[model samples]
Target: MARRQRTPRRTDDNLPSAIDRFDDAVDAAWGRVFRGHPVADRIFYLASEVGDFSVLWLLIAATQGLRSDEDADASIRFSLLILGESLLVNQGIKRLVHRPRPTPTEPRPLHVRSPMTSSFPSGHASSAMAAAHLLSKRSPRLRPAIYLLAGIVATSRVHVQVHHASDVIAGAAIGTAYARLADRCVPGALP
Candidate 1:
């Protein structure tokens, strides 16, 4: 028999590793855990709803008048910051990153409405964190509550299968950075 030449297989470093796949795996795992839990679905649905731009605006409108003039001013500025950050994250960074959403292994009811944009840094988490960071600065007494809401919103993103854990983490970091920069740019923006 004639011998045939052997060729080596090429490896593409660009391919995702198990480490890189960890986020998606975690997202899928969370979806599996919350798949049929009615209470969890309801809570996550509500939490995600609070992060919607329109819902956030309503929240601002409802509470703006209840606080002092300075506090109200801070709240308004905080909302503006969130709006700007959302725009930047959704339209700019998301497109650049182009990270696709996690594909669930099985069909399950989503707690929140379907997402339209690419999933990398979550808009909901970004807005939630921005609001929490700025609002907490405006009212130190409400810091814990503000963070709790933000945490809920961020967690809901994962549970609802709209975002990976890393997506929320990136969103939070970006949001906090933006808030800090906004405060630095406008000295009184935080409080």
Candidate 2:
């Protein structure tokens, strides 16, 4: 009997093969299933826009302003917190990671313009999750719906070929942790 030698597995030098495969699989799956539906495209476009501009969070803050002075103050603090988180993720962390955006494997009209920064951590996802976390904590009654929109906004990056699933996951984690910190430091931000 002869012994067989094993060949070395392939890798991307910077990222592990497993992670690369997972990212590729997710990107391919999303492109295959979610790229061409008219209604879904529209929905995701709107969601992406909301995430980009923090439109929903701004609207929530504006509505909170109408209710009472305390609510208004909390909303302003929440907005500032999310803005800081977005800046850190977009400028600091993304430049450090320097991972390129995924190459478009499918033809889908991008709802929002492509981001100029690197794609390791999604700014939109980070901002969305941070806003969702703060807002939901304050308004427990709307938590489920708030998080759902956050999720959709994060996933929309992958759907549109701008980010990998892992990128969004990392962004979500960063956003959640940052929001928790804000909640702790600025008492009453959560409630």
lDDT of each: 0.76, 0.82
Q: Candidate 2 has which clashing residue pairs, if any?
A: none
Question: How many pairs of residues collide in each model?
Answer: 0, 0
Candidate 2: where is the Cα deviation over 4 Å? Answer: 1-15
**Mind sharing the TM-score for model 1?**
0.81
Query: Per-residue CA lDDT of candidate 2, range 1-191, in tens?
Result: 89988888876686667788999998777766877888778888778877776777878867866678888887787777877887789779998998889887756665468888898898878888888888887789989998998899989888777888899999999989988888788887644
Runs of candidate 1 exceeding 4 Å displacement: 1-19, 57-64
Can you write out model 1's per-residue Cα lDDT over 1-191, one digit (the tens) per residue? Answer: 99997788887776656535878677667777875698988888788877777365338534853678776666677667777888889888998998888665555565457787888898888877777777777668888987888888888887777787888889988888877787788787655
Tell me, by TM-score, which candidate is best: 2
Weakest lDDT window of 10 consecutive positions for candidate 1 = 53-62
lDDT of 1 at 27: 68
